[model samples]
Target: MLKTILSISGKPGLFRLVSHGKNMLIVESLTDKKRVPAYAKDKVISLGDIAIYTNETEVPLHEVLTSVKNKENGAKITVPSNTNELRTYFAEVLPDFDRERVYPSDIKKLLTWYNILIGADITDFTPEEEPATEETTAETETNAEEKTE
Candidate 1:
């Protein structure tokens, strides 16, 4: 089921819920005023608040109650990652390439593509063979003269 959060205080008030899909919640505050909380999208439900949703986290009102209960009773709670945060995480892991070299402009995928595209071979690293030595130049000159003779 989709996760949610709800909060309940001593007084009657509304709470907010934000999820990728609709979920059910039961909030009964047994405090002094017996505040019956309602579901809200943004702020509190009774206040007609809108909720925020994405791949990362959901600040749903109903889940607020669950969150508070967990805190009071020592239950476990896990916060979801935000979509933007995850994207940024991936971006940081991606290699930093010369901007001029990448074509399509997708930094993330381009990093992976580059690793597969080109590779070095043993021949490409043949030990620094000394430059054309003076002896080699003289041998070539002598060969040319022999042909003329």
Candidate 2:
């Protein structure tokens, strides 16, 4: 669902990918529906591809956003301007998030993005499960054979 949503650096809000051109992409603003051509020089990052740093590993942005949504009961959260408050809020959502790697600004951006997504009625953040690998499929077949024997 978030595949077409893009966060272009230097742009104020999110954009939905419309179509691709030879050296650029045609995008429409999620907020104003203003269609614009994003050049190859623009830094465009998909919301699906973004992740947050955790102590154990990186957690996908969608999961973090989902947690925020669930915690706030689908309401927009007031982004804390104070650094300590921001840290506390992030800790509540992701206790094991790497404090050093995840800065206050990053947290602020996440909260802002979450609010934007929520306002746009794009709350579904559930990612599709990956298909079983060849090795796992083979193991399942072998186990079935043994069970039948």
- Steric collisions counted per model: 24, 0
lDDT of 1 by residue, 1-149 (tens): 11222333332322223332343334433223233434333332321122223234433322333333334243322322554443443333332322333333333332222221111110111123458989999999999999999
Q: Candidates' TM-scores?
A: 0.18, 0.85
84: Cα error in model 1, Å: 24
- On residues 29-146, what C-alpha lDDT tens digit does candidate 2 reach at each position? 8888899999999999999999999999999988999999989999998999999999999999999999999999999999998888888888898776779999999999999999
List runs of model 2 lying over 4 Å from the truth: 128-149
Worst 10 residues of 2 by lDDT: 121-130
| Backbone clashes, candidate 1 | 24
Clashing pairs in 2: none
In model 2, how large is the Cα lDDT of residue 117? 86
